[model samples]
Target: MNRCLISAAMAVFFFFLAWAVSLRQALLFLVGIGLGGVLAGARFGFTTGWRLLIENRDASGVMAQLFLLGLAAAVCMPLLAAFPGELGAALGPPSYSLLIGAFVFGLAMQVADGCGSGTLYKAGLGIPLNMGILPIFALGSFLGSAQLEQWLQLGSIAPVGLVARFGLLEAFGITLLGLIALGWAALRWSDRIAPWFNKKLFIGAMLLAVLAALNLIIAGQPWGIVYGFGLWGAKAATALGVFDPTANAFWSEPVNVRTLSQSVFLDVTSITNIGILAGALWIAAKRKVGAAEPRSLTGTQWVVGIAAGFLLGYSSRLAFGCNIGAMVSGISTGSLHGWIWVPMAFMGSLIGVRVRRRFNF
Candidate 1:
């Protein structure tokens, strides 16, 4: 079948999948698909307009990411303002823990080669090791979450809302225009800067805007991906009875426990992760990205990567977002955590690079 037909068929299939699932979950799943698809496209060297962000090689991915985040934040502002108490409540009050957790999680992303969403997408695309890493990372999240449940109990500073300040359309429209212009400028600047930037800047920025908006429309919540790791992790642990029931003493309420648990089965992110892998595999098969195969890595390397993934996943949950969740979605909402996580993760990536080199597996 033609690529366009295949793409259209995939869209239709997802539409039906969305229809069969809750709208919220459907939207999140689609968001995951979009994210994975874009990354995969970039990997393939297909600089399709507004879809190129393969390696984040240039400022292309960065600009697009900023736009996407800006759009979401703009939309969320009004929603929060209208329901001040509710908005203030879901995001919770910010705390110092977010800072600490975000930094560590950021580092984890570097080690893992991708954040939660990116990891899933890469695995989907037939990255031999990432496929193995997915469940192991999930396992790490579970173990780490069990260990860090206490810190999560603490809350953070409340986020400011737009609903309190402006109407939905007014907020979204203003934000959209500003974000688009900013993205456009960033793209133009990148094009003049270097080779990498020129090819991907505008497309990356536009996709960022599109993904963020699509996430808002579908998820009813802003885009996020960290919780999926923790949820899956927690569930896996719970199934194994690895956690002590009293370990949850840090929780302000039982609802947190339930939410954490529900993430395993109910989180749209998790479902999307599964779908992204499936979609990527489908595409990879046709494109000859290479068939999935188990690679021969040493036992020690596996343990280190898995351990690093666990640290990242657990830390991401504590911070309340992963790369996608915090960096993408949180930033889109203009939350402090997003900003905090990005730099921290970059530093962590440094550690990841070192570890990869040291192990040399």
Candidate 2:
């Protein structure tokens, strides 16, 4: 089918998904975000470079991320103004600890070859090992959050928005426009950088930002990812007698809190993550690349990657998102943790890459 037809179909599916899922439920939201990601890949003809993170091919992800991040920030400003006490309690003061945590998460992404959300998309497309890793990630996140609560406690930072003094549209518009301009100017200055400046990324980012903002306006919350997966995972584990009650308190009941947990999981965007997976699969099938092929990796690589995923997942829970949810999504919302996590995660990623190389991963 043509892009127009595909886009229209996806739009309808995602809208329905948003309405169908409940607050404090994120499976649907993750689906929606994943759909957004697939839409991004589709717009680019499922290029391997883009799909698998080749040189500058993945710049689309960066652009989309910047736009989304900015929009998130704009929305957050006014949110805090309207609910300072509440926001303060959940976010805490952004600190060095968050930075360290973020670095560790980033490192894990490198080792895993995908961030939390990225892994989900690949997993949904029948990447068997990703299937295994996803659950391990959940367990890790649960354990990490439970164990590192105290050390990471000092980094709670509340969100600040340019919107409280302004308005959502106004703030979002300014931020979005600024980013667009920056992207444009960056591309304009260097022809070599031209290849990295993807129009698809820009379009997808803006479109998703608008969609996300609208969802928030109507649904009474911004977009989020981890809670839905965490809750679902926790519930499943609890059912299986594998999860510990004391350690699993937050994981088992992420929705009960009056924080972003409820909003992230329960919001309309939950379906976005799911849709991303489906959309990626749809593109894969159309391109005749739909077969689920096993990725060949050393046994040692798998063990290390999966083990690292546990750390990554747990850190994400403690810090509020994996790469996409925390670093990308969290920072975009101006949560402060986003910036802190980026560098720290990069450090961990450097180590992770070396580890992968040592294991021939």
Instruction: Work out candidate 1's RMSD over C-alphas.
Output: 6.1
Query: What is each predicted model's overall lDDT from 0 to 1?
Result: 0.57, 0.55
What is the TM-score (0 to 1) of candidate 2? 0.68
Specify the poorest-scoring 10-residue window by lDDT in model 2. 44-53
Q: Cα miss at 139, model 2 (Å)?
A: 1.4
Error of 1 at 324 (Å): 1.4
How does residue 40 of candidate 1 score in lDDT?
A: 68
| Per-residue C-alpha lDDT of model 2 across residues 1-361, encoded as one tens digit per residue | 3546766766665465446654323344444644545444534221122222323324454455565557555655556456644442123236545666666776666667666656666665556566678788767765655555475556554554434435556655665665677456434433443456466666665666565544444445445555555555555565688766555444434443333234333434344555565666555445444654666877777798788767667767665666655554554444445545555665576576666567765
lDDT score of model 2? 0.55
Question: What total of clashing residue pairs does each candidate reach?
Answer: 24, 46
lDDT assessment of candidate 1: 0.57
What is the Cα-based lDDT of residue 187 in candidate 1? 60
